[model samples]
Target: MSSISMRKTTLAAAGLAVAGTLVLTGCKDGNEEVPAAPAAPSSAASAPADGYATPPAGGASSAAPGASAGGYDGASGAPAAGGGAVATSGQSFKIGQAATIPFTSGSKSGQLALTVTSIEAGNPADLASLNVADKVKGQTPFYIHYTAKNTGTTDLSFASVGHIKGLLDGGAESGVLLIAGKFDKCPNESLPSGFTTGKTQASCAVALAPTGAKVTGAEYWGDPYNNLNKPAQKGLTWK
Candidate 1:
């Protein structure tokens, strides 16, 4: 099968497993990169409080279109074993537990707060609901849901949905399934359109894993400052 067809099949399986049905929605087509503040010519302006140079306004993610449902190129199957958690200051959370990470500085500058409300293992029955052009074997779906709000007085760009990642035990990274407006089982209030000050929307992403994959936990990196090799923010442990 073709790569796009394979991705759509995997997405269909994941969507049904998580949402009770398939409702694909969101800005996967647009090349609109995450926004960053303009650079300054003077030496004093050269440095931003965050230390890293802002991504250019039109800069696209390194991943190509349909590269993988959630920007990964690897296919769904068993991954290499023996992975550990990424080191991070993120607090531990339980399923349905809510955690907030407030933006203290940078382009966001107190204007944004990311709230992760829940995490859960997906239902296998939902997988049966899918009508696939092809079948992806041994994979199951997991979900991470959250809300991003703009607390500032002015309108700022809100695109935190694409940045989050998921992993299984042994540090196997899951493929992110982009959800548009139709997340049936995993209802997120915000998505497609983003947040303005006092505006909040719920959104969720489905991560595909092999059946019987031991998913002991999940992680979220709201800030890019997190170490790529470890969990840099918050996580959940299934009790």
Candidate 2:
């Protein structure tokens, strides 16, 4: 080869070497990070054939429209083992030995038609009747334990059914003192129905001569009067 050609070839080789060295230097300096590839989205079609998809982000919770808000995915079936919905039976109650105090027959006019399917006393001192009646039943303040779908239906008020007659002793029925109106007397504090964690309509009691001497026997009316008898306050009333 001619000297000039040789010299040109030498320069070309040096230039290539310089370019390679610069690239090597860049790598060694760590000036640039290797770019990460974009991730592919999850495939809905690839979901498990089983009715359930993997539980939501938080264990078994996934929000499905019109379904239980959380912890419950609208899927069908009984509640999951531990981390799902829990069903509750209706509130059932039994009446203790009940006493019916008679309302003056001529005084009030109506068919006292409240029905009592079952009655049992959860506790002796405090009586609880199931499905008693309203004024139409001629029974006031009788407690009927009930269970219902959580329809958000409840009332908060005070009621007064005038002149209830209860038989304190086995003797004849006489007028029992009425307080806020529904409850005959403040229930025994020890009773479950005595107080609730989330309510204000405390049970009523007559200003009896002796403490806890509430009306007991009248064979016609240990009625469970309700607070629904009064003019509703704040538009919230219970039945």
Best by lDDT: 1
Q: In model 2, where is the ten-residue run with the lowest total lDDT?
A: 50-59
lDDT of 1 by residue, 190-214 (tens): 2333345667666665556677884
What do the candidate models score in CA lDDT, each in turn? 0.41, 0.23
Off by more than 4 A, model 1: 1-110, 124-135, 156-160, 187-194, 221-223, 226-239
- Cα distance off (Å), candidate 2, residue 237: 25
C-alpha TM-scores of all predictions:
0.44, 0.19
lDDT of 2 at 132: 17
Candidate 2 C-alpha lDDT tens digits along 123-166: 22321221211211222332322111111122211111122122
Model 2 Cα shift for residue 222 (angstroms): 10
- lDDT at 96, model 1: 48
